[model samples]
Target chain A: MKVTLIAGSNREQASSTQLTRYMARLLEEQGFEAEVFSLYEHQLPLYGPGEAYGHEEVLKLSQAVKSAQAVVLTTPEYHSSISGVLKNALDFLNSEYFEGKPVLSASSAGGTVGVSSLGTLQGIVRNLHGLNCPEWISIGSDQRKFTDEGEPADQATELRIRKAVDTFVHLIHRMYG
Target chain B: MKVTLIAGSNREQASSTQLTRYMARLLEEQGFEAEVFSLYEHQLPLYGPGEAYGHEEVLKLSQAVKSAQAVVLTTPEYHSSISGVLKNALDFLNSEYFEGKPVLSASSAGGTVGVSSLGTLQGIVRNLHGLNCPEWISIGSDQRKFTDEGEPADQATELRIRKAVDTFVHLIHRMYG
Candidate 1:
């Protein structure tokens, strides 16, 4: 199955991006084709009505999401919710693109937990008609979760991520296998 | 007192912008200095961490909001909430710029009502430390609310907007008069 992992932060070297990469690796290890879609590479035009929606970047990102069998979304908390970059990217697409696809909601935060961001992502995914996994992965105190090489630093974080990814993979398989 | 009316849509001839301009006219009628800030004119870069914050447009917007005694925010409902263009523009600044400032939340929608968008905008303003007015203006079936000259079409919609603006102006006077 092809699963798309969206690193929802636009920041270079963001902890959220590191966590997304880790999830991608885990999916690959499980023998699934994982594509990491970095927000940095898809700098979308601000979505506004009557504005030209023919931007190549927006179309590329949309096509990727449309083609994926399932999706994994990772974001960093900003103002107690998902980052505006992620939300803005989502705004460019309609509910039809995400209809009935399983999505894994994951987040990393500077605080002890990223529950709020998880909830926000869940709400957004539901709004877009994507079925979000009940078991979400949130790496709190995120700065410590990743090492200098952009990999998960501790075994505990790795285990949590693996479990979450496994759950998502299983759900997708059950739904679309 | 100075009031900033933000036309939160990027469309060339959006009803949201028309309603924002209408509100600005009402404020002017009340002898308040009102400035209409159109998101189309701002054309802000997508906000992200570690991105250069020195963009002249961002700086100008920040200065305008910081200097205004009160702000009236208007948006078109996109996916049951504010437009991404408006939200991305907001991401360029921090809560400090809006601290203690009065804000009037307004919206125009294609449906029969825009209550959801009003609630969402209210929450966002509170998150940004802006004191939101309780009397919000939501123009539903928005296409019918405006004329060819980009003005409010009916006496009823005009009255509703005037009442909201009057309430906002009174609150600002009580706070900063």
Candidate 2:
């Protein structure tokens, strides 16, 4: 019923966020309640002795994560992996937040190899005891932008993104129902 | 003959720094030139279209990375992976910087599971084409600190740190030689 979306990019308004927002909108159109949590806004201290266990930010983040029915995480590939900001947030709530949640991962990259970041994240998530959607929503930079009229100027990419969103929505519905 | 150690933790001074500083000290004692760079202070911007290809900070960071004959990267584990700050910095540099250089990775975590960050980092460095030493250094939190004055508060941890340092230094010498 309630789905939480995490925008994993550190940039104020990244393509990953825009794409995820678009997907969230589609999910809403299909009758699911959704909320977006921008990871960049969470000011988490570096995990350490005094900070790792009971840091205020950690506790607050964990509480938010505990209440979610399903989570959608969006990230941009950095050095062939997920951003530290996202990983740090996930690290804080490990077995507690991720135990039985169905997580859908989506990624945006600058090249045809947008899937690299997705693959790396999948590997990391699999090892963390997460149940991930078998098909990930991956967008490369070939046709990264849209016009002011909200139309994708590049037809090929428009089709790809449409398919990605449809598949993701299907996966979420299957997982939740 | 100059080696630059990148301390990846966000803390002003961290165990990774302590361990990296120890390596620098050992290298200096053995008569090799070295310097340590605290990556947290670099404040690198997240990679974007214009930012990733070339930026002032990216140029400066890459220059530092390129100038070094060998590099020692130290990080704290977060979500079974390396920190984004360090990965961001590495992503700024092209593969030429790491093509044939020797790299040593060390990590300090709060528990036995700290090995995740180390393993993740090793995978990244290898993917970047850095010649990594097979033996990596991993220190759990229970063994890294002391009460007040310099003392071996935990003999077992002291021994592990010493062994880790020794292996790290030996590999550096071999790589540099």
Top candidate on lDDT is 1
On residues B50-90, what C-alpha lDDT tens digit does candidate 2 reach at each position? 74556666677777778888788898877777888888777
**Candidate 2, residue A20: how far the Cα is off, in Å:** 45
Over the stretch B8-85, how does candidate 1's per-residue lDDT look in tens digits? 899978888988987888888888889888999888888887654788888888888887989989999888889999
Q: Least lDDT summed over 10 consecutive residues: which range in candidate 1 chain B?
A: B126-135
lDDT per residue, candidate 2, A117-164, as tens digits?
765665555455454443467776756575664445677766766775
Q: List the residue pairs that clash in candidate 1.
A: none
Show where candidate 2 strays beyond 4 Å. A1-177, B52-54, B146-155
Q: TM-score for model 2?
A: 0.47
> Model 1: per-residue lDDT, tens digit, A33-82?
89988998778888897654788888888888988988998999888999
Docking class of 1: incorrect
Model 1's alpha-carbon lDDT is 0.79
| DockQ for candidate 1, C-alpha atoms | 0.01
Residue B147 accuracy (lDDT) in model 1 = 79
